[model samples]
Target: MSRWSGMPRTTRWVVRVIRPFLQVFTRRDWSGADRLPTGGYVLAPNHLSHLDPFLISHFMVDHGIAPRFLAKDTLMTLPVGGRLLRGTEQIPVYRNTEGAAESLQAAVRAVEAGQVVTIYPEGTLTRDPDAWPMSGRTGAVRVALATGRPLVPMAQWGAQEILWPYSRRLRLLPRKTVRIRIGDPVDLSDLEGRPLTEDLLHEATDRLMDTLTTMLAEVRGELPTRPRLDVRTLEPPRTTYKRLEP
Candidate 1:
């Protein structure tokens, strides 16, 4: 039997406690919820705002799946925040540290045991001027490959409207629709069994990002006129730890 079976009680409780408060912040127009399998799937979605986590976690909780994530090491160290993360069984990505491998391994186990691993592949919020999905890292792909889990691609809109990332502004008035739609499992069958080489992983990552970008296009009703911004090309300090390479 899978160890991660069943919805996480902590998630359900958090969502229940926060749902009413969340409604006070933004409205929701969620779709493709039926697309959410009971478990053992990689939840890949575009990162727009810090609010994405709460919104996505709320989505999972409402739908009966325990919302889990690979959080940053710093978050896992905060007094209260770390306690909650650990209490809920969230994995930690020891970013920029050697421990990053441990986080990837944990994600694989979570998926194999039928748990939801929500990952923001853009790593952080989109530095994309247009907020199109940035070039993705291979961390999510590696976990999928290792555990043979389906990487379910999805796109979200309106969370940024409520609170843009890195901006202290909050425009919570006039409830906004946190539109989210879950798409089909990305087809990585061709690359699954091959040796997990750097080039191969990059190619797989491209396909995964492409699928997510297309979904974002559908959500926005407009395709990005410019190419995706590579966070790696940015300032060295910002590059930090992106994907967990093979």
Candidate 2:
């Protein structure tokens, strides 16, 4: 058995039950799944809702692939939820903390072992409120290039309408529709043998973001208003951990 086989059985059971319920409630539609690489790969998706990871996990399971996500370390502290997270072999990422490299190394090992690693390159959920993807961090590109894994750019919409981020509430009154679109894998063969530099990583990140922007625009049926970074500069650094009582 692979090291990932150690993922908690309880977590698997919970996901098996909960994912179906979520699908039914949201009336989700998934497309372009065939485009996902069967072997080791990185899934880069736009973050808009807390439900984004679960939605992607459901589709990955349906496709006969197991996705080990890179989640913030804080989520692993919730009572029942934390136990399930540990059981799933999900790696913890200490955002903006000194231990980020160690967390990233864990992700690298997972990818090298031919596992699917899902990440929100944007680091945090969109602060735009409209849920369009913002400029991404270089973590995804660094990990992908380091492991020589294929990067799959995924675009999703509708989850925000179900469980809106920042609203801290679920909208169950009106049944929401969720759509997931998996784009073709991005080839990074040209950057082989070279160190993963900030410039190259940023360029690749932009490519991923551009693809996501197109998909999101198609979903919303309109282009999003560009964000004013100057406003972001005025705010304090966001923390990766959510303050949930244990």
Candidate 3:
């Protein structure tokens, strides 16, 4: 059994409460669960909607993994919700501030301590018109390299159909099918033990994002177009392109 299944009582209770609600609105088509490690690791998933975390956690809990999400600091400050999140031991990220580095450190510590730390590599919802993954930040890579833990890429689709990105309206009439695929752990052996430099982090991050995109293509049964958007550069998606084979 995965050690994370024996999570804190509060987190277990929260999972119990949330699972039923997710089941009511979505059908799960999850695969590659056997690849999940029994020890500490990093989970990197593409961000599609605000609802992605709930959907991902539901999948993880069902498969005997406790997902410790790196969430926005604002969510950690909510009146009632924040208390629950803190009790559940979710990591809060203070983006673009002096405290930002602290979040990455906390994630590294979480992995080193035998917990599943989930970092959305994109850091935010993909701005791609088709919701394909954009260039990712190095937070996930940093956590894995720091702890020498497996960095698992989990690709998901269908949440956007439920709740479109940046929009509050939810479509609940016909239940949506959420497909999740856990790909093989990204291999960073070459970069392991090397000093983390800008070039090294970028290389590692690209390998992860490429694997995630390919896995997502498999789940969607289609190809993804490139050049991938670099959210940091605010690059616009190309109006024309050919799709790459999965």
Which number leads on lDDT?
A: 3
What local distance difference test score does each model get? 0.80, 0.77, 0.87
| Candidate 2 TM-score to native | 0.87
| Model 2 spans > 4 angstroms off | 1-8, 227-246
- Top TM-score prediction, candidate number: 3
Worst 10 residues of 2 by lDDT: 237-246
Better of 1 and 2 by TM-score: 1
Q: Relative to the unseen true structure, what is the C-alpha lDDT of residue 103 in candidate 1, on a scale of 0 to 100? A: 89
In model 3, how many backbone clashes occur?
0
Candidate 3: C-alpha RMSD after superposition: 4.7
Cα RMSD for candidates in order = 5.3, 4.7, 4.7
Question: In model 3, which range of ten residues has the least summed lDDT?
Answer: 237-246
Which scores better on TM-score, 1 or 3? 3
Per-candidate clashes, comma-separated: 0, 1, 0
Query: Per-residue lDDT tens digits of candidate 2, residues 1-246?
Result: 543244457646766688768766877778998787766778899888788887777777777666588987998999977877887788999987888989989989988988888988888677664667888887888888988888888889888786765556667657777788888877677876687777888888887788888888887799977652222243443443232111
TM-score of each: 0.90, 0.87, 0.91
